[model samples]
Target: MLTHLSIKNFAIVRLLDIEFSSHSTAITGETGAGKSISIDALGLCLGERAESNMVRKGADKAEVTATFSVKENQSAQAWLQAQDLEDEDHLCIIRRVVSKEGRSRAWINGIPATLQQLKAFGALIVNIHGQHAHQELLKPESQRAMLDESGHHDAILANVKKQSHEYNKLLKHLQSLLNEEQQRIDRKQLLQYQLQELDEFELGIDEFPHLEAEFKKLSHSQALLEDSQICLFNLYESEQGTALSIVDDALDKLSELVEHDPTLSAVTTLLSEAQINIQEAAEELRHYVERLEIDPLRMQQTENRYGKAMELARKHTVMPEMLAAHHQALKEEHAALEQQDNDLASMNENLDILKSSYFESAAKLHSARVKVANKLSKQVTEQLHKMNMPHATFSIEVVSNGEEKINSHGTDEVRFLLAANKGIEADSIEKVASGGELSRIGLALQVLTNKQSATLMFDEVDVGISGATASVVGQLLRDLGERNQVICVTHLPQVAAKAHQQMLVTKFSDKDITETHMQPLSQEQRIEELARLLAGDKITDSALENAKGLLQIQQENLI
Candidate 1:
């Protein structure tokens, strides 16, 4: 509930501070007295658009602050906690400031906030029903929303919305796949042919390097055999100065001098070891020469294998060593395309399941709305009767579109129909009802359907109502105030008299400035204000007595 409002340089309000209680409060004033200035300021604080014209003359900026007590408002508390804007003592303060240039800024709990955040948080605590709300009530969407609210169909509507979203998402994917069907077929066929070629080749990992080496060895086999024979002859088979014979001659000369000098003995030992190494090396060369042979057939076979590997590498646009990896990559791509085909095959069945689920939930919602519509129609008609339209017949028509149309709300179209007089056919409210009748019906719906907000503000919603009907509207608001804080701006004395508290708005103007002031009225002041509202500019003795009687009656009724 709103606990206080402070306005500065806002419209005609120069500086005003008004405190509110948790009950019905009536704001009354003469024409052009700026009765709605406070409401307008409160609207700005609730995140309404701000304009430069709202600022008072000569003021640089306009500011409005609204304070709410959220001790019992769990939704508001949760919102504040989620926003990290929670304050101690269960208090929520929203302030909006507009510069003279039409720039606006907002704060929640002293932290900077965006307008959307303020609007989101404001929705949980306050519901402002403007004087022209009846105009909005004419919309079919509004009618449907009211019906849904009355039925408490949030969970069911959510299910239907979820199902619809998923159905549309899958349907779009299926359409895309169908559109690309030919392209996918062509690509798949190409991939299949390429993969078949690669499969037949069956290139082994690291086999290309070994094949190249073997081809080189086979192609040079004759040259290799010739070189080995020459090396063998020089190392051991040469009869003149073979390496073994030279080493043997050196060892014999060193042995003959060993007895003359001990140093010669060490030299002889080294020479003997050298001779043994030379003999072994020569024998190994002889064996290699004997084994060396050239074969033309094996050389041709190796050359062909290596050439084929190189040709395939060029055809596949890969290095010879990378053919195996490239083959693996192509296989992976083909596998993914195949999986897409699989998904496309099963998508229609999935879409059908989703469509069925959506329709089922929509059907349940339609049933619930129909049931609630009947109850709501009856209750609103009863309220209309009390609001002075005794002959009014109200009904809510809920029609389903079946599978022809669907939306996030559901498949049901809700219409509010009314016949203001007897023997008149009930028709659409917008086509048949007058302005005053629309206001009454709109009020009835508001009174019946609004159950969430902690505070309800009716800004002259009783505009076309007066006399006994006005009194009934006041009483209805008073009843609502018993459960939630209610604020009403009205020119009707009967409505003002029924309030637990009252405030008077008066405009004062001088040569240079016009200011609007609002003050809470005392018991005597309330009677005086009510008398003025009843009798116009003059408050006669009878008007005073009538105002007192009205208050007296309201007090007795409360008991």
Candidate 2:
């Protein structure tokens, strides 16, 4: 429950501080007396959006602080501990500051926090029903959400959500497989073309060097043969006095002289050995020259083979030696493409399984929603009658137009219908319910669904009713306060008199500056304030008597 609130330099409020400890508190003030401003200031501490226009005329900034005693609010306490922002004494203080320049900052338990964090923590500690909550009651989504909350459909909804998530994942995987299949087709066509070209060339690893060598030898055969002949002649096969013949003639002369002188015998033996070596060299050169022939056919064959390999290498932008590696890579790619059909089939099967699971879960959720919708409509309609809207007929419509696609929210559409007056047929709540009816209906739903111990703050909930209707609204608020702390801002004396604690908001001019003041009313002060509410600027004796009687009746009932 909110224990204290402080506002400074906010709108028409200069400085205000008040403490509260009651099951039911009412804030009463004249129109334009800044009654709503106090709630707005509290909202800022709860992380509502802020603007520079909310700042006081002469102030540079506005600040608000709300303190909650969370001794009974375990959820809020646990959240503070989880966020590492818990105070030592289990007290939660939320503060918000807005500068004239539209800059805003927030803190929870004196620790800095983001606006979203503040809002989340605030939700755990209190539920503030703005004066405009009726506007939200008209939204179909809001109606569905409220129904789900009241129905306790969390378990079924979780199943639906899980199935939907997996279904979407399967859908994404199927799309990826389809995209890959198309890509594989393109890749396979390219790889097949490359492999066909490679097959036509009939290339091999290490073959480039051998082919080049053969081509070189065959292309220069005539030149090689001519050079070999000149070399042999110079060495021993020359026509002009062959070297072998010269050596032989010298040896014959030496042989004749060797008989005359025995020392000459060694010279004859040396000449004989030289002649034999020169003759053998001449014979070997003749054989080598015979083997060297000018064959244009063999040369052309080698040139064409080597030329095709080189041309293919250039076309593929690879070295002739690297062509074999490129061909191996293409083969591996083709093998993957061959396996694509199997992979795509498996993905499609999984996609079908996911769809079935999602539809099954969605069907269960839809059934649960329909069952709860009838009970919700009956209960809310009863609550509306209790709020003095006796003729108000409320119902939750759950319907499906065939088998709708599975969604996180399930397949059924939910709407709230209403008839605000007797003899009126129920219609869509948004189209038929007036603002006053909307407010009561919204309160009815809230009162029925809210079981949290957090305080409930209603800002001017009795906006369109007076007299008996206003009194019933007051009693409704009072009854709600019996279970949880409740604060209501109102202009009705009946509502104000019903509060266990009453606070009055009054605006007055001081030195040409308008200032707003708030203070908890004493017993006599409460009666005077109630009288003022009844008589407006003129508190007559009769109005005072009426205020006295209203307060007495509320007190007697409390007893």
Candidate 3:
């Protein structure tokens, strides 16, 4: 329930603070007394679209703050905690600040929030019905929504939502499978070419290493042959003295000098070891000379193998060393694509299973709604009869044949029907309801949904009624107030007399400035205001007596 409202620099209201009672409250004033401004303030607080024109002249900005006592609002409390906002006890203050620059800000419990969040909270806090009710009756979708809201079918709707989700998943899977099949068709020739190239080479991981060794020998063939010939010449075949003979002569001299000194004996031992090493070097040099011959066929084979390896590496965008990993990955991808026909069949089978499961769940939800729709229409029409629209033919507008596609909402569209007179043809309320009739219809639907909603606000609901009809509206308002807190703004004296609490909105001028103020009317002040509403500019004796009598009657009944 809305407990307090504070407004500043909004149109005719410079500054005003109004407190509310938990029962039915009546707001009444003369014409042009800024009565609609109060409801406008509430609309701003509830995240309505605002413009800079709402700001008063000479004012920089406009602001509206509303406080709701959340002692019984468990869902709202949990939502606040989910957002990591404070929820100490059940008091939440939702404030809105609007600037002349078209900037707006919202706050919940003094924590800043966007307009979207403010709307989410407002949906849980209050339901306002004004001329907007006529606008709502125009849309068949809203009619369906209201019927579902009255029947409390959110759980069934949730199940339909889950089914819709599964259907979408299946559709996406089918699209992906088709896309892959198309790609395979486009790349058929390319895959065949690549497969033949790789297979002809008989590629292996160690093939590159063997080819690299051969290429090194062929590319430097002249250098390898020259170095081998030099070794052979020095050790065995050269006409000039070779290294091995030089060492031989040095060893013989050292052997002869060994008899002269023992130091010469150590030197003669080193020469003998050196002569043995040269003899082994001469044998190895003869073998190297015989084997250093280069073959042109082998060189050609190495070059061809290296070119093939380089081509595959460049085609796959990889380094020579990474060629092995790339080769394995392509082989796997080709292997997978080769079996796509079989894989596509498997995916289709899975999609069929998912679609079947989704349809089965949706069918159950549709069954539940079909069972409840007729009963809902009857209930609303019965309530309308009590609200003085006896001839109104109200029914749930649904396709009885169940031919529409099942969606997140079940396969039904609900709308109300009405006729003003006995001979009038029944038409949808969207096409044919008068101003006063629309207000009463909105009131009936809201009061009907009181069990689901937390609080109800009716601003100027008694717009198109007078005399005895106004009294019946008064009685209906009292009935609603008994069930839940109902705040109604009215100019009718009868409606004001029936409220548990009545508030007066008035504007008065003091020298240069005019201010609007709101306060709870005391019992005597309540009578004066009621008389003023009854007798406009002149307070007649009969009007005052009638107002006093109304006050006495309401007090006796309240007691």
How many Å off is the CA of 500 in candidate 1?
2.1
- lDDT string, candidate 1, 376-471, tens digits: 999999999988889999999999998985568889988999988999999999999887788788878878877655688888988777789889
lDDT of candidate 2 at residue 322, scale 0 to 100: 83
Which structure among the candidates has the greatest TM-score? 1
TM-score of each model, paired residue for residue: 0.79, 0.74, 0.79
Candidate 3 residue runs with Cα over 4 Å from true position: 30-32, 49-51, 172-184, 199-214, 228-299, 313-351, 400-406, 419-427, 451-453, 507-515, 531-553, 556-559
Candidate 2 lDDT, tens digit per residue, 108-216?
Answer: 8888899989888878887888887888777777877888888877998898898888888777776876878778788889889988988777777778889989989
lDDT of each: 0.88, 0.84, 0.77
Q: In model 1, which runs have C-alpha deviations exceeding 4 angstroms?
A: 30-34, 47-62, 81-85, 97-106, 111-117, 204-326, 507-515, 531-556
Q: How accurate locally is residue 211 in candidate 2, as Cα lDDT from 0 to 100? A: 93
lDDT of 3: 0.77
Best by lDDT: 1
lDDT of 2 at 556: 93
Residue lDDT tens for model 3, 392-463 = 766656653253453666555566777766888877887888877776676777777664336678778887
